[model samples]
Target: MPKDARNQSPELDPVIHPINRLRICATLYSAGATDDRQMKYSTLAELTGLPADTLSKQLKHLEGCGYISRAREYGSTRAKDTVWVTLTEAGAQAYVQHVEALKAMTEGL
Candidate 1:
């Protein structure tokens, strides 16, 4: 292995290693790639194909760790409320590092 590759053996981030969370991070990362860093909760739900409760649980965990931010947007009616989610700077950095680790592990394969 190259020295740079050898030095890139970053530990996998526990928070992002789970499939659900990894998907979430990947979605958010792609969104940011298009200059749209935030996404609606409904959009994330649709992308992940996860039930509401399960998605909520995962969001809460990511938010608790300061990896993501959640905000509520309310319209004139109670039915118009929406939740918005965005990946935080820290979260992006962590996810990128995790990906680098994955790449390093697969380099020789």
Candidate 2:
């Protein structure tokens, strides 16, 4: 666990601390354990049980933080477009560090 220099407390990543964001990161991490980590936007939405709009907002925020990236394949219709989501290398590292911090904080309990 990386700690603050002054207080020596484990640091939690604010971007990944939200419940929904945490779930999204965990889902992406689990998918990454497989051969291919890239997941379709709709598939991610289904797995997370999050509405499309909500998922889109969360993904946007993660992308802004360089935690995730999205690629879009245009189809005939906007609804038919396929958006692929993947966790970036930086994102994977941040998620792992965040989880470790969480574990360290809870280990005493």
Candidate 3:
């Protein structure tokens, strides 16, 4: 629990924010657990159960928001590029803050 978890604005209403969406962000960022590296789309899908296309689109949105980075790589083939996703500094901070915010909302009564 965070030091400030006990304090939060009821008006913020974290339930509306939902857990799974947050889970997607947090879990993906957890790739930092090993060498602060990134992960692939298939890897994330295995963890989050979000379809590839769905994850791709949502990831693009996160990238647009400056929360995540998306890179496309060529594998010596003419087909679509393999994707790599990583958390930017902004993304890591946002994940931490979002977790803190949600923890505050769920603090004991």
Name the best candidate (by TM-score).
2
Model 3, C-alpha of 26: deviation from truth (Å) = 1.3
lDDT of 3 at 60: 73
- The TM-score values for the models, in the order shown, are 0.85, 0.86, 0.73
Clash number for candidate 2: 0
* Candidate 1: Cα lDDT at 77: 89
C-alpha lDDT score of every prediction, in listed order: 0.85, 0.85, 0.66
- Model 2, position 6, has a per-residue lDDT of 36
Better TM-score candidate (2, 3):
2
Q: After TM-score superposition, what is the CA distance of residue 31 in candidate 2 from its true location, in Å?
A: 0.8
| Model 1, TM vs. native | 0.85
Q: Mind giving the per-residue lDDT tens digits that candidate 3 earns over 1-109?
A: 6767535343432421445556667777676722257787668778988887777777777778777787678787846567777777877777777767656667742
Model 2: per-residue lDDT, tens digit, 1-109? 3355534546789999998888898999988822246898888999999998999999999999999999899999998999999988878888988998898778741
The TM-score ranking, best first, is: 2, 1, 3
Candidate 3: residue 14 Cα off by (Å): 9.2
Give, for candidate 1, the lowest lDDT window spanning 10 residues: 29-38
